[model samples]
Target: MNESKHNTQFLGLLGQSSTFISAFSVAQVCLTWYVFSFTGSAVAVGLVAILETLAALLVSLPVGTLVDRLNKGMLLAVSGVAGFAVFLILSFNVLFFSFDMAAVLMLAVVWGASREITRSAGLSALPDVVTSGTIAKSNGIYRALRSSLESISNALAGGLIVALGVLSGFLFSAGAYLASALFAAFILLPFLKSKTATHPSGQEKKPSMLEDLKEGFRWLVARKGFFLLTVSATFFNFFMDMIITYYVIYVAVGINATSLVYGLILSALAAGDVSGSLIGGRLNLLKYSGKINVVLFGGIPGLCILAMGIVPGIYTAILFTFIVGLCFGISVNVWLTTAHNIVPPNMRGRYFAIDGALSSISPVAIAAGAAVIALYGIMVDFIISGILMVLFTFVFASMRSLWKLDGRVHKERPANEAT
Candidate 1:
């Protein structure tokens, strides 16, 4: 009975991610197209993207605290329910009325809030339900399937949008959110919170939110060289956001690609994600060459971005996008797995929240970047992004802590192999 219950919870957990993400992925493509078509300005696109993510940056720190204080499972369910409301309302507005930018921006806040709630809670909730032996396999499966779903969704989104209109995609997103919420609602995981967990010294008194927030930062810095590396990691997100925000503009304004071509490129990117996850997980090579793997995965993608800018052909752009996705797949799988092992379960929520908050700052940086691209052009913007990405990646690799930490980590493993 216990094993059966665990299986149900595990599946529920996967369902929460698989359903919401896939739906959102499809909706994302449709929404981007809608916004670009409506405004025809890259800056406006950036503004919309900024609004969508702004909530995550603002609330992540507190979310770290709340995740520790409250029931994670309940929080996720509530967030999913909130997502249901956000999208459902938007769907109705689009179908019955018209596409109001003000309404879209306002509803985006609620959508982002819902997304923020699930970001850390889902990962932190994993250990309680999944046995230690299977956590690694489960995570790989989760990522691979998530990427696969994104590929399928992106591939279909354009055809679906043309066939059924963007409004239908919004409705599909609403349904998917509801389904995910229901799945999370029934997941019976004992991923409970403990007050004594705030500090390493086992203090009986409960810590304030400020204290919890500080502990997260304190722990991140304490982990060898992760503190500096953490800051460097932000550079990746900064550039990544710039790319995502601008790509839609470039495709629409610069190349005049049709919706079909746009969807194909996005699908290629996701297909690479699927390939990277599968190929990267095939061996424990990353465990030995952690820094190298991370660098290659990250740096090479920047080069791809550069090539796309220089060449700017449809086929080349699709090829480069796929490489970018492939690299992301390998790097993400490696780093997330490493983090799961390195960080303690008690601190996972806070730590992930802090990391998320830092990474979420990408939107702000990309806003400034958008200004530069406005002055120059899209091709030049890609060239600059590629150069800076590579430079920062190597700078991140230069940190001593990563090397020492990797050495210590591999040394601690019995067989020096990632299970």
Candidate 2:
């Protein structure tokens, strides 16, 4: 593709996805902070995460199948609409009806379902929008923006809660979601719909749900790198679950942090994530070289944890968290790009869906592990999660030799060259 075309597509994706993802991250941080403030329990915060992931899992199978058969753009728009409604309802209840935990949980489920569909569709639609060569940069830019947005939202959310109160914060979150829906419909969806809508003549009929599921599984099994990448992602998911579900809460309890301080810590980590992701974009780190780095050196986060666990101070903890966040951002950009590159364009949705479903199961394990942490404390959990990550890093680094798999399995062909 020409430079002009590439830039246009990149800008379009940036506009729509940035708005939705920023708003989504803002809402999530606000909700989590609110829940933590209200309940004063780490387990409660963990439960919210558990519920969200469970809801995503429940909706993932059908949504994944539907994306493969339908226009992914339409699906993304519908997801935006659903998300808009959810935020509106939550806003109304929180602003007027007394913001109860039950009401919040209900909205969380709605948000979770919308998140599952939108994420799956957004990922699948990428190949329709950008040339293969730019896909890694695309992933990098998306993740970078997402991380930055989340951090900015966290920073603003802390002040929003202080100045306007929780109700106003929730309402503001609703407005952001509404804007996201509008941007998605007018900008991103139209671009994608034009490319992905038609069924090719003599194309086989859409497969049944079971058949689709089986086909996705068969495809994954046949592709060794893709399969290992997914498996590594599962372990990665567990480590992240620890960070998101337990780390902040640990900070709050261990350090007796104020709400603003907690927000600051989160924003700090997000800032690291943003930087890492953008660097990834410039480096094209989603390529094979970047992924190999994950296997060889990803133990940096483990070392960070070892320091945090031994020192156990707020400043040290925050620094450790930030380092981990940076490493995670790099790891995620490489992981997403590698996996997406492996799948056929048409099967991208199903591939990501199955990936989501498989990854979803890890949260259950994470929640169980959280319970253990609650009893045994984070010292144990931190050491164990860190060690596991280090081990997985080595395993992933050795995968090429062990599995006899080449990284460039699904090279992205230029759009003009498409037959």
Give me the candidate number with maximum TM-score: 1
Alpha-carbon lDDT of model 1:
0.74
* Inter-residue clash pairs, candidate 2: none
Compared with the true structure, what per-residue lDDT tens digits does model 1 show for residues 243-354? Answer: 7767766676668787778888888888888777776555563353357443755588888988888888788989999999988877666666666766667777898888
lDDT of 2 at 312: 74
If scored against the real structure, what TM-score would every candidate get?
Answer: 0.90, 0.88
Question: Candidate 2: deviation at residue 199, Å?
Answer: 4.4
Off by over 4 Å in 1: 1-6, 188-204, 286-294, 407-419
| Error of model 2, residue 309, in angstroms | 2.8
Error of 2 at 415 (Å): 23
Q: List model 2 lDDT by residue over 1-419, tens digit each.
A: 43424565556656657767766766776788778777877677777777888889888988878888776767777777777787678777765675487777777788888899988988887667777777777777778887888888777877777777766666666676667667667777667666663456787885578888787777776655557666766766766566556665666665666666666777877888887776655664434543544552356877776566566777887788788778777766666676666668777888889889877774576686677677877766776667777877777767663234334445653333311
